[model samples]
Target: MTRTPSVSVVFVCHDGAGRILLARRSTRARDEPGTWDCGAGALEFGETFEQAVAREVIEEYGTGPEKIELLGVRNVLRPGSHWVAIVFAVRLDPAEARIGEPHKFDELGWFDPAELPSPAHSQLPETVALFT
Candidate 1:
């Protein structure tokens, strides 16, 4: 079987306590529409892992390179494809960072480390654990 490879980026911000930024995907998305997800995308032909993560953050959240730190990576296989997510930690002023438009994300918000919402990816809990 041919495995489809994809990339995902998780943004964690720390204030007094840490919070994870979660996005609600649009209903028009090919997969998992209307579900909550982290900022993510697929790797292009010539892109490096860091480049892909950086690109995704900018594309999804308008974040720049200076704002992020690569945390680690996680490999998750679901059904027919494998996802290699490049995890990242970005410290942002919650009051300054706002969700951008024109992305698949319909809604955006910050969730406490222990209080994530439902319809979130199955691997998200494990992914978040690594940061704490």
Candidate 2:
């Protein structure tokens, strides 16, 4: 089997207030089911990071970002996969969020940053730290 690293646009959406949006991974998710996580998607061919973020936000949350800000980048390595994570903090309207991808996410919630849900995604801690 041939393996290659992929690039992902990882984003956490906020309302410009103190609340951040998270999705609960469904059993059908790629990994870490039952865990709470921010949104992410593979970068499409010829697409810029910003373009990927916008597409993913609409796909995952059914909402568009009001503002997108670059956070940082990380080389994410797990047991079977590796990715270059391009992180972003996106501001959006809280009222418009929904579980756009039913197979991947079972729930969507707006949470206070300090009171996040239990059993977070493996990369969540590092990703959340970049929100500021």
Candidate 3:
């Protein structure tokens, strides 16, 4: 891969009450299979952060966001790859959330922020702190 970094729109979808949605990564996921994480996708060229987040939410969660709040940005660096993670907290209808991408995620769930699922993506804890 080239040394250039890409931009990713990472977001946590919530019910506006308290619970946040998470997806369990499947074996086909690029990394961290079996770990739970927020929804995310590449920032397609010419699209704004909100657009990317909205599109990703529907494509990943099968629901649209009622509200979107930018939490913060993160420079996510790993061994071989790096990306700029623009994080957001999105409010949506939890009842409509399902695993939109079956090849990438095997399961989906909503949990209290204080009691998120274990074996989370390595960056999850810090990312959650940016909002809650």
What are the per-residue Cα lDDT tens digits for candidate 1 across 1-53? 56567765555544335777777778866678777766666778888766776
lDDT of 1: 0.69
Candidate 3 structure quality by residue, lDDT tens digits, 13-123: 888888888899999999999999998899999999999999999998888899999999999999988999999999988778898899999999888888879899998
lDDT values, one for every candidate: 0.69, 0.93, 0.91
Which lDDT tens digits does candidate 2 get at residues 41-74? 9999999999999999999999899999999998
Worst lDDT run of 10 residues, candidate 2, spans 107-116
- By lDDT, the best candidate is 2
Q: Would you list the clashing residue pairs of candidate 3?
A: none
RMSD score of candidate 2 (Å): 1.1
Once model 3 is optimally superposed onto the true structure by TM-score, how far is the C-alpha of residue 98 displaced, in angstroms?
Answer: 0.8
Candidate 1 lDDT trough over 10 residues, lowest sum: 8-17
